[model samples]
Target chain A: MGEILVKEKEIVAPGDVLASGMDYIPTDGAFRDGENIVSSLLGLVYIKGRLIKVLPLNGVYIPKKDDVVIGRVSDMTYSSWFVDVGYAYDAVLSLKDASSDYIERGADLTTYFNIDDFIIAKVLKVNKSMAIDLTMKGPGLRKITRGTVITITPQKVPRVVGKMGSMVSLIKENTGCQIVAGQNGRIWINGTVPDMERLAVKAIKFIEQNAHKSGLTEMVKTMLSKEAKK
Target chain B: MSYNKRFDGRKFTETRPMKAKTGVVKNAVGSAMFQIGKTRAIAAVYGPRELHPKHLQDPSSGRLRCHYNMMAFSGSGDRVRPGPSRRSKEISYVTELALSPVLDLSAFPKTVVDVFIELVQTDAGTRCAGICAASMALADAGLKMKDLVCAVSVGLVGGTPVVDLNYEEEAYEEGAVDIPIAMTPRDGKFSLLQLDGDLSKEDFEKALALAKDACQKIYEVQKNALKERYVEDKK
Candidate 1:
């Protein structure tokens, strides 16, 4: 049997041994060196069954295929729009992939999406060159209007969404806010009341600060309830 | 036995007073300002983001780039130049090499982590201080590394090996030898080693031992700075 070295939620530096033996499998943020599984980054260790992985505490977003992301329209060409998905290279959204309606060649593409417009889209493809293609024709993917968009470290998105999105759903249920978290670290919160919107944003910030701590869902629950009474 | 015992009135093996703080640059992803006696350097870390100038991007691993600069007003007496000089370029390359070993570059494919170090004040040990501050800034930016790199300068003055030579002591005419060494304190692995002037083989061994001890002390200061940013104060 493989022996687990570090406890769950423990902060580990790169090269710190996390486990030892053949019974355990190393995942992301971990690499096997001889008989030991070592962490490859400074992060929190997570163990489930026989698998171990580390969650990075800080890093920029690397967009993967099929990831739903929130992006800003930066530039528009003759038939396509360039979107800034918080990556090194801007993603391309062609006219055909942007909308269901037929777009004539050389049509005014800006009419469909203008510069600085917030968009909710999905990654269509990511080539080896890091060139990305985006599509807005999927469910929950469209142009965002009249909402506040906030950016946090993309690595913390999983924590903000929680297991099955329990944490975000709690915030929505309490404040009646429409919250959308992008895998690219951008979050959109639209609430009926400005006060609720502010509260949702504050809650998200709290998640960003304390993402490594366990029992965060309960903490957020209490915090939202306390703020609701106020 | 020579000029006024020691200019700074410190023991041969004693280091200068030091202070370090993290997150000093509000806009940088991670930053640190460190001072060792009169020498001060500030470092800021950006990225793990996409590498621009597409041709330089490494497909299999992340690339770390460092820029070391000395402000015009940082040097005493005469003002220094404003742009990159050959001396600064060499220091920047060595500093990057000193820090790259600790980082997990393979984990961040095709991305680049940039470190900018500015020598805000000079006192003959600027390179050592710059390397020390850069490591702290990298940790502050949440870059996962095996260990933090800490460094100290050992100089031979008046036939005695001294730690952290000041500008005056560095100018000693009696066979002055300056050596800046950087290492990972957790495992005592040397990351950087450069020498100026000459030293006897025995003296070189002694200086390396002294530098190892001084770097351990510097490591404590670096560790505390990061802890202050992330860990809660007990009191």
Candidate 2:
């Protein structure tokens, strides 16, 4: 029982060669059998007649519970404010849950978080009700006043963050950027200057491409030091 | 008639057969029945337990799994071609995306909550129906959440924002366009938006406004269904 190789968005009209190497259908969906395939690894599935294929799950922000994500205050209500972390749901930072500090009656929580003010928080839960609650009570949860936030595959966030936060820590040490990791697969990399931001982005992307391998700390430290020199 | 109406003799913006039921499954931790007109979707929730394969187990933040499916005969004239279609798979993806913000996966480690959504009949807006049903199902499953998420698609036909479109209205070749939005009305935040086609930013804003209005009504329906289920459970 061998695997098959199906192309990405291959146009197979009629008796076209949908796959090669193996006669059997791939158990995984991104690539499929001659027919009747599902992109099992989270993506958009498109079908024509009986044949189906997939477009890989793109974008950096896929949703997950307890993912410490970063976002901006898009809108506010009496009870909660909508934090647009670029996931399907705008994370709700409720009045009671936003912080440890007591919010008095009629005290505009807006002072704490105004529209477009960036922030970092942890996802508490996603109910069948689809309500996303957030709390700023984690080691990295806080307000991101300024800098840059780059989106990457939520699946690759671990790689971007590196083992035990080594990769992120190095970037902070070298570039002086504050980074926040969201569980839903979003990262807020805030560097003081454009160059630092660029360096941070480059480092994150490096982790993304080579996340499967080991010894990423030395690799990232070397990469950032080299970029800083240039 | 001062204004024209649809096939069901309802105003363009008027919703159809909006009914909601809950507790359809006893085994499920939570469950809900959500319908927009004739389209019906059943959602159920389970877990907060060890996600096996074991290696994926994290000490912090439990895993979340979601499935959006349609019954074989969910459509009027067509037998639903099963086994995770792309549309349904995307539904599963967005369904997961729409809820992660509220799930609090960090509090529970090594546990996973699985949400399953099945459409018994689909006219239009099945994804939104599944999302709405799934949210209620989580509640029935006894999962804690900040609040409910209500999703609805408002299309623009004749440049007007029509709340909740049926299959015919959706497939119609002529007329204006529409957009789908998932939101939590209690807070003015959007969950999911599968808006395609073309529209000025203005039309897009109006569609969002219409979706917000529709979600408010949907929020009440979602609460009532959960309340009824809990009330019945006691009985």
Candidate 3:
């Protein structure tokens, strides 16, 4: 038998013991020491059955394979385009993986994706050396045009998307904005009226600042409605 | 312990006034400004993002780098030069070592976390104050750390060990020994220890004990600084 020390959604400091039992297993943001599972970060604790993990309140984004992300074109080489995906190493987007059309060797690569252009792409692969491979050929993957992009802490992206995307859908439906919430903490919002776009940004910021609070979805819904009428 | 009165007109174990706040720099991930008596230092933390110059990237875990500098007008008399000095380089290295133990580096692999500390005002014990500020900046950046690092300097003046020496006391003749120690307050384990001048074995032990006690008081202040920041933001 093991004892669980923290309540659900409670803020826990690093090195705080989350649980003690041989039957319990540690997950993300937690590590095992002897018979205890200790939190390794400042975060909110979530326990599911015997598996316990901590949700960090703040951190930079770490890209994973198959994640949809928004990146800016940083540099161009003979055969590849380096994308700044908010990570240490620029993700490589080779011409071959970029699109279905074959690009001629030595052809000006800027015509396809120029420097400082934002693109919504997918992570094709991440290697042992942390070399990331990206692709723009997938569905919903293309260059972003004429929309405002806002960056938030990547740890809050899940909250912005809400459970099953109910939160995002509410924002889109009320404001009539085409919003794409990237897992990398970059959001793309295009609205017919500039006020709507600004409203969406404000709502997203609210989510980022108050992600830990309960009843956030209801609060966001009320806020959006009040702003939409104005 | 026979010194009834000291240069600062305080008891031997007394410390200077401390004030600290986090999130001062808007651009950096986390930032803090700390002042102990007349000694003030500001620290900023960035990254867990990409580590540039790919060759320096560590494969197993994120690298922690610190830069400690003193501003030109921070000293008492002549203005210091604005550049990296040997003393600054050594302090930066020790500061990095002091903070590395508490961070969960493996969580952000193939990245780097940079902490920059600048001494805005110098009385004495600036490096120790810088260590304290850097720890708060790291926490304000929301990086996962096991425990906050708290530090204070203990020095021997007139054959008596004193806590938190001032500028004049630190420059005493008679071979005064200044020992600065940094540790994780929760566990009472020392992460950084440096000795300047000379002390006997028995005296060094006594100084260490005094420093450990002073660290506990400093830890309370550090904890309160962090809580105050978050509490205000909640409202």
Q: How good is the docking of model 1, as DockQ?
A: 0.36
What is the TM-score (0 to 1) of candidate 1? 0.88
User: How should the candidates be ordered by DockQ, best one leading?
Assistant: 3, 1, 2
State candidate 2's DockQ.
0.01
| Candidate with better lDDT, 2 vs 3 | 3
Model 1: how far residue A205 lies from native, Å: 2.0
* TM-score evaluated only on chain B, model 3: 0.96
- Each prediction's TM-score versus the true structure: 0.88, 0.49, 0.90
Q: What would the per-residue lDDT of candidate 2 be over residues A1-230, giving only the tens digit for each residue?
A: 33233444332111122344343343323344234232322222344443444332222244468777778899999878899875434778887777778778888777888898888888887664345778777786788877777766565676666679776787788888777776555677776688888888888878765553457678787887788788
In model 2, where do residues sit more than 4 Å from their true spots? A1-230, B1-4, B232-235
Residue B153 lDDT, candidate 2, scale 0-100? 83
Candidate 3 vs. true structure, TM-score: 0.90
Q: Write the per-residue lDDT of candidate 2 for residues B15-52, one digit (tens) a residue.
A: 77678887687666567789888989988777654477
Ranking according to lDDT, highest score first: 1, 3, 2
Model 3: TM-score, first chain: 0.97
A1-230: candidate 1 lDDT, tens digit per residue: 78998898777655567998998999987878778888766667899998999887776678799999999999988888999998866899988899999777777777789999999999999886677899998889989988799999898999899899988898899889999999999999998899999999999999998776668898899998899899
Q: For every candidate structure, what is the RMSD over all alpha carbons to the true structure, in angstroms?
A: 3.1, 20.8, 2.7
